[model samples]
Target: METILSATGLLTPGVEYGRVAPLADDADPVKAVGAVVPVQTHSLNVGVLTEPGQSFPDTDALITRLRGVAIGVRTADCIPVLLYAPDIEAVAAVHAGWRGTVGDIVGVTVSRLEAMGADAGRIMAHVGIGICGDCFEVGSELAVCFEDAGLGAFVLPGPFTDRLTGEPMDPDRRHIDLRCANVSRLLRRGIPEANISVAPECTRCSEIAPGPCAASVAGSGMTLAVGSEGKSAARSGVRLPSWRRDHGTTRRMLTWIRLREECPS
Candidate 1:
């Protein structure tokens, strides 16, 4: 059994490229090595934003041996995992939602990076923005699925009392910690403790909180839905523009990772 640990500020900003228009005049947002874009919205807008005539074409995870080429993975409630292998000087960004998790996409990505000569032990992992355990309530079947994946334990029949409160809690609402789960998975793969980092905030929980902070509750999920949804729905134009743009920005926001050969004892 591997002991899961969190990262402590070794990752740094490589670069940022907006997936949308008004290219920031700094670095062409289109050709950044690991750029994050909406999963939906098949538009010439994205094409135009990217470098001339260069199209990624239906890729959720992007990895590169090319330095200064930052890959990105867009997510709201889903897990955005960024991996870096210092030994090979390569990196990968993965989108692992419940569906992706069950598919073992994270493991597959690690394997892919290793195939490219990345040392698993030298890889640093970051499990970015998504729903937290306390905020994400799910069905028993789904809970079991996470357990099967080695991310969590099976929930048993009970009142599901709050561990902190020592009071009965709702049985129907069991919170799943997707970030911690992924951290466990990474540790199992031999990634060191000091190399992994997790965002302390939860989008869904923050959304439901009172006031201006609460105003953006639906933003994350909405953004992800737009990109992951098919062409018809995304192209329907019913979705808000901010959702589209924010999804693109979320791909560029905080959270980074760096793999180191010297382990901290």
Candidate 2:
């Protein structure tokens, strides 16, 4: 399993987190990994999904305080963000597809964390594995989305081949770096650079299970290990199984986080 190390060291002594690698593609994440029961998961749409009532329609993010209740989001090339707010002992799982990114989903989630009394200085975030900027080619429209994100680096020239004319297109196609874009957004919101950890893996180019299929949006959640703060974890979805890849097989790995019951201080 590809894991990211935290430079901020904000996870409560008891907090722990992990992601499903290519080989872990199984029937259920909870059944396979979570040792807890009654975990609450939601069906994700786009744009900061949430489940106030559980699997709520059009919801993309959720905040929970229930020690054993786990929340997560699914994604193919989209970014998955898990937040830990030590003060309120709450966590947030966010789905940042391109549309959601443009809508400032990260900021919204941060705001949600704040509503629960999270402090920017102590908050920890992980920019999970997803499509990097180079692998995610786009058009002039999405290319310009960088302006909104303030990550001017999000858009870049990608290989452009014209199928109809049998020639390479001019100026190249554009690619969007979803990872940097999200990181930039988080930085703008005051989440310390030290507090955010970026996954070392990239789903678009890696040979691992070649997953989060066109239809699968793999996802997961957050939690502390054992100490003064609290605990939590994240797990989530793959694309919904689309035919975009024609003959490609569909697969999705679940990434999750769980907060254990706090230890007696």
Candidate 3:
């Protein structure tokens, strides 16, 4: 598993696992590794996040103030976000696919952390595995979300030709850089640039590509299918999958942003 390290200043460090699925129900969900294990096993004795006989709820994020509690997010293509606030010693793990991104869940989490007494600067954020801008092709309407989020410039003109196909990318087809968008959001929230880091890998482009590139196509297809069903279906159709879909990419990107107070002189 590829993991990113934290910059020296923040004491609460985290690792983002690329291409790894949360242990299936048959697997142990709570085995902590690295810094998270000691917290999970010794200090905070909590059950694994998954529940028996129920699909993990459509929860795209988890936050814990319990030291040694390891919070994990599973992603095939969607972005997994990990946040740590050294001052309060709290950590949050988030899953941001297009809907979550547009909903601005990351910013919401940041606000929640602040409400919990975490200084925005003392918080170190890591945006993990997901599809990249070039690899993600969506519609103009979808593209507007990023623009609305202030990352419009990252959108490139396309017929973003598919790496596998020479066909012109659809006009409705918009390529999204989930990581860049999130990083932009973090910076806009006043998180310093030097405090932020991004992974260079694209799940779609990696050997561990989460699923068939067509998974996005399938997801979009499903959205369209749901739209045909009814108004409610249409409204819900636009939402991103809460769990792993397709064989989506799994390469994790680990980067960090630290607050001024937490920064090392």
Which predicted model would earn the best TM-score? 2
Worst 10 residues of 1 by lDDT: 222-231
Candidate 3 wrong stretches, greater than 4 Å: 1-19, 22-58, 164-172, 208-265
User: How much does each candidate deviate from the true structure in C-alpha RMSD?
Assistant: 12.1, 9.3, 13.0
**Clash tally, candidates in order:** 9, 56, 14
Whole-model lDDT values for every prediction: 0.49, 0.55, 0.50
Candidate 3's C-alpha lDDT? Answer: 0.50
Writing each residue's lDDT as its tens digit, candidate 1 over 41-137 gives 2111111122322445655555655444334544546666777676766666676666666666677778777777888988877676566565456
Write model 2 residue lDDT over 1-265, tens digit each, in one string: 2222343333555454544433323444434444222222332332222333344455666666666455565555567777777676766667777877777788887877776578876777878766666556667777676666465677766574532234664555677778888888888888989878776445544333222221242343221111111111122222221112212533433345545567425
Model 3 error, position 48 (Å)? 14
Name the 10 consecutive residues with the lowest summed lDDT in model 2.
Answer: 223-232
Give the TM-score ranking, best first: 2, 3, 1
TM-score of each model, in listed order: 0.58, 0.67, 0.61
Superposed by TM-score, candidate 2 places the C-alpha of residue 220 at a distance from the truth, in angstroms, of 17
